[model samples]
Target chain A: MAEIRLEQVRKAYGGVVAVHGVDLTIRDGEFVVFLGPSGCGKSTTLRMIAGLEEVTSGTIRIGARDVTELEPKDRNIAMVFQNYALYPHKTIYDNLAFGLRMRKMDPAEIDVRVKKAARMLGLEDFLARKPKQLSGGQMQRVALGRALVREPDVFLLDEPLSNLDAKLRVRMREEIARLHQDVGTSMVYVTHDQVEAMTLANRIVIMRDGHVQQIGAPLEVYDRPANLFVAGFIGSPEMNLIEGRIEGADFVAGNLRVALPPGVQASGEVVLGIRPEHLALTTEADGVAFTVRVIEQLGAQTLCVGEAGGERMRILVDRVDSWSPGQSVGVRFPAAKLHLFAKSSGQRVETAKP
Target chain B: MSSKATIYGFLFVGLAVTLALIVAPAVYAVSLSFYQMDSFVGAPKWVGFANYVAVLQAPEFWRALLNGAIYALGSIVFQVILGIGFALVLNEAFPGRNLVRGLSILPYLLPTVVVILTFKWMVDGGIGIVTKAVEAMGLPPINWFESPGAAMASTILVSVWMWTPFVTTCFLAALQTVPQSLYEAARVDGTTAVQRFFHITLPMLKPILTVVVLLRAIWMFNKFDVIWLLTRGGPVGATENLAILSYRHAFNLFDIGGGAAIATISFALLSVAVLIYFWVFPLEDD
Candidate 1:
């Protein structure tokens, strides 16, 4: 196992840059996920690390050796592509043993490693079957098994579960997490799905337009996002970012006036961010006047999406079946949970954490 | 009910065309093989397989059959091998790739007679480019259509040149259907470019390759025009394949029944060969 390091890695296709200078170090046994939307260069960065895409400028190292110039085969890494990319003609056994066979390992040892990976991936019964004979989930496992048999220094996965059905994706996601735990090898995963990043990654590197937004643990980024994009992107019911101005210890936007957190440093135009779950429904007389437009009952939590002082806001609260559309209700934004960002730069304006 | 009627109507038309154009001619030819006739207008007398027995007894018939096999096998082998090589080169990203691909298909697009005439012009004695170059290199001028071996080689070379573009186009289109991820996966799996071609590219192309080879084999075995135009079965019956032999028996010798017998035998041989080829390399994905 080895740590993968990228120092100012960049990728450009002619004049257009796909990945800007990205400097990141994935520690040994760490599960780092590059999370971003489509065309945001998350997959490009992972491909660069895997040696599948050439780094236009800068260095990448696997362990202590520079691997940016080496071929993928010489980088001591295995990748599971989004489409599973299994050898369709080969049986599962051959697909798993192909790498070892290419490396000219002993035939007996290749058999041993292949069988071991198959058993671990619950693919022993599928050894004689071709890729077409297997289900989407089974093919995904075979893809994972193919990488496992290589026993490389690092594992790179490019949205490996994106092709499976929803339920299968969840099951395969669990299987991947379990595989990582069992192998204890460094892994670099790329996905546009925030849920996958939040659930599986030890550290989530959020990106936008080829620039890193924030890199932190799941809850850390959720609790304290570094920028407006990160704040809005990291949450399920996206965080409400209201365009407003900070004036005299209060945020003012149209007729809405909410007292700002104490010791706020910014003074000009600012964007206030607050998560849905951080708000609460109170008596009409207790908090700000909120008119509920729609109510979504989500098992234990009822999400109230409506206008709070003429600004769109979503308030998630414990089951409140009493609420309905066009109902007059009061919602309170806990001061401690309120986040603020500079509107000009879109960077977070640090406030005291409660 | 309307859709069903439409399907049946289309099937009836297709069956009618097949019977009229293909089956009818085949049946007429087979029936002709069992009769004795000097010309199409002459009274054909029922010979009851006498023409087949007489043709089988002739040494030229056996030699023509052997020559046909050699020509077909040689042309198909070279065409397919060179076609695949050119397809691989054309598949790669290059500056003028589209232009090159268009030019590569030029040979296949040309009329067969035009291509044959061009080949004849290129290898012409005294003034042809090939003859001039051979003389410049102090090598003996090639007797392209004089010697038996040279005549056979010339025909094979012309056939390969005229038809390799068709094979390359088919293989090139097949190469496009392969997913790019498969090659990346192979590279990650520690395969060099050669290994990747053999393991991934070749296997991915198998289904198309099977069909292409079978089509090329059948066409080359029965190919008549290119050889007829280039060598006309040679100086000493060297390039006289079954097709040429059959044509000569009918037109030149005025032995219509003998020509039909050879044609029937050639058709039967091809049918059996096709069945065996499919048995060895079935087109369906396993």
Candidate 2:
């Protein structure tokens, strides 16, 4: 078990930088997920940590060793790739035992570890079978077992569940969590799916366009996103970001005005942010006017999409009444739930009044 | 019904060409083994298995068969080795890689006669650069074709030089299909470059390698032009293979039945060898 430290790690392909300088330290045994959309350098950063991609600048440390120039094998880290990347020609047993055998471990010990990993992954019956004979989930388990047998200092997974079907992805996600808990080894997972990051990570490092937007606990980032991107990216159905300006302690857009939260300082242009679940249905006179354009019944909660104060907004409510398009209603944005960001910079503005 | 018609139409064309060009000539040759004739239009006498027995009993026939095996095996071994080496070099990322890849296929693109003559020119006793290089290196001037060993070596050398590019191209294409992640996984699995090649690259290439070797073997076994143009089965038939022996018996010696019998035997042997090869290295993985 070792903590990983990335100090100002940068990756550039010619003049096109893939990953801008990223600095973060992963605590020992921590499950840190690098979360981002495609081409956001999350995978590139994970690859650099795995030593599969050469870092353009900065150093990578696993534990106390400066493994910046070391080969991946020498760094004592095992990686599971997006496609599983299991040796197709080899049997499941051989695939699991490959790393151990390469390290010149004892035959008995390698066999023991292979058996244990197979049992852990429920692949004991498939030891002699090649990768093609297995399903997608089984193949990914073999990939995980391959990493498990090595007992490496850290585990790097690059979208390990992306190829699996939805139901299988959930099962594998739980399996990975169980594996991590059982072994207590540090794992660095990369994915574009924020749900996977939120569900699987002890800490989620959210990135955009090669720059890290925020790094915190799943709900910590969900509750308090550092920037506009994180605020929209971390939640389901997205947060409502209404463009407006602050004047006389109220956020005003067109003819609509709402009392701002206390301690608002130096905010002329601001983007009012609130989640769909935070809006409450109230009397039309006491709240912002909302024209319902589409109503989607989401089983327990109904999601209503419409315009509020001349800005498109989504509000979620547990309602039994059937709603249709063109219906006007009033939705109140709770003060504590309202998130405010600087319109020009997209950074969160301090809401506490002096 | 239209798709069915299209499929049948394509199949019929292919079958007609195969039967007319390949099956007919092969059947005619085999049938000639049963007859004794001085010329194609002469009064032919039925010989049955007499020609086969006579050809099989000849020492030159056996020697030619052995020479063919040696030539095919030697050429294939060197071709596969050098082909893989060249392919591995070409597969790496380098400047001018496409230009080098295009240039590498030059020897294979040349006609057989041109390549043979070029080989001859390069090893000529007086004006050859190879001879001059050997002399400059203070090495004994080697006989390229006068001796039996040198003659056989020269034929195999020229064949490998002319055809290694084809094998290299096949291997290079196969190498590209190997997913780069497998190599990266191997690297992370604690493998050096050589280990990765053996563990991942070679296994992934097995199916293609099997087919390529079989093709090169069959073609080299029946090859007549390169040896004929270079040595002409000379130096007391040192480089003579089954094809050369069959040609000599039919054209030079006018033993048509004997030539046909030799050709028939070579065909049967090759079919048996191919059967054995498939049995040993089946293409489909279990």
Give TM-scores for every candidate, taking all chains together and pairing residue i with residue i.
Answer: 0.98, 0.98
Q: Which tens-of-lDDT digit does each residue in B252-286 have in candidate 1? A: 99899999999999999999999999999987865
Clashing pairs in 2: A262-A353, A263-A352, A263-A353
TM-scores (chain A) of the candidates: 0.98, 0.97
- Model 2, A1-354: lDDT tens digits are 899999999999999999999999999999999999999999999999999999999999999999999999999999999988989899989999999899999999999999999999999999999999999999999999999999999999999999999999999999999999999999999999989999999999999999999999999899889899999899998998888899988988887687877777746889989899999998788887899998888889899999887788899999636678998898897888888899889998866531
- The CA lDDT of each predicted structure is 0.92, 0.93
The residue ranges of model 1 lying beyond 4 angstroms of the native Cα positions read: B1-11
DockQ of each: 0.83, 0.76
lDDT of 2 by residue, B4-79 (tens): 9999999999999999999999999999999998898898899899999999999999999999999999999999
Per residue, candidate 1 scores C-alpha lDDT tens digits across A72-177 of: 9999999999999999999999999999999999999999999899999999999999999999999999999999999999999999989989999999989999
Query: How many residue pairs collide in each prediction?
Result: 0, 3
